[model samples]
Target: MGKKFLKSDEEVVDPKATLEVSCKPKCVRQLKEYQACTKRIEGDESGHKHCTGQYFDYWHCIDKCTEVQMQSAACSIHCICGFSFALYSLYCMFLLIWSMERSDEEVVDPKATMEVYCKPKCVRQLKDYQACTRRIEGDESGSKHCTGQYFDYWQCIDKCVAPKLFEKLK
Candidate 1:
């Protein structure tokens, strides 16, 4: 008998070709619906016909993306937006505007926000900063790089968290 090749239902269906393969199907649907809503918001004549009170859901989608973007940025040095890093950039822009729009009393500094968002990473950076300072001053006492040691606080912190701080600095 000749060998037979069999294809599973998923392979036949090719969900990757469609928009239905994600674990978060609801989020995917929300993104599509929100894009449709935005077309109407842009005053597109064709879009207005399908958009009735759906605009509110559009805003909710934006809010959701922002939350996910911030979360992904915090947890992983890489963004969860995946190949669509631009969406994450949009999320950062939205965050910047949202933070600025708040009143002075409500506004939180970036350090406080960073501490909350990326606590472990931030604390590690702080420790690195301290260590770097000891090295720059040539203090061998309790220094890990102990043997005629000198440290640069600026260099260590800057080196450890340069990429992270670059985002905020910009």
Candidate 2:
């Protein structure tokens, strides 16, 4: 999909540069500390000394800033019933809204429901398949099978159920 599914179709972005630019102002002190630590570690050929602490402090600052921005941008929409989903996860919020103004009914399994409803309509095909099975039972030669009749029965039920199932789901 090579960037086709991205929210933007513009030129490729340098994420590190973007993060640095956005985080530099609020995290300048930590950034300077990290830079200084790097300079100090430059002569350590054994590679035991590191700047992990200062790097994490800088990232913590960026995370705090990003969290505030995400919160501000995320729940800007005020619900008509005067409730806000600022505290809830996005998935729970979606489920709450999607079920609103709809029936308070039990959940259903569409395939099983369609199968029960379609069984009566496909009785003829089922009977035919059963007879084919009986015929195959008498044959010592394993040349005959009830596959055709079984498929016919399945096709009959599917023809009746597929369109209705799609409609109900929609």
The candidate scoring highest on TM-score is 2
Best by lDDT: 2
How many residue pairs collide in each prediction? 5, 0
**Runs off by more than 4 Å, candidate 1:** 1-3, 6-11, 15-19, 26-36, 46-170
Model 1, 10-99: lDDT tens digits are: 346443223222223434555577677566346433321334435555445445445444444343433333436777667765655554
lDDT score for residue 109 of model 2: 54
Give the range where candidate 1 is weakest over 10 consecutive residues by summed lDDT: 142-151
Question: What lDDT does each candidate get?
Answer: 0.45, 0.67
lDDT of 2 by residue, 30-104 (tens): 799999979865755544456887899788767765554444334333332345555554654564455442312
What TM-score against the true fold does each predicted structure earn? 0.19, 0.38
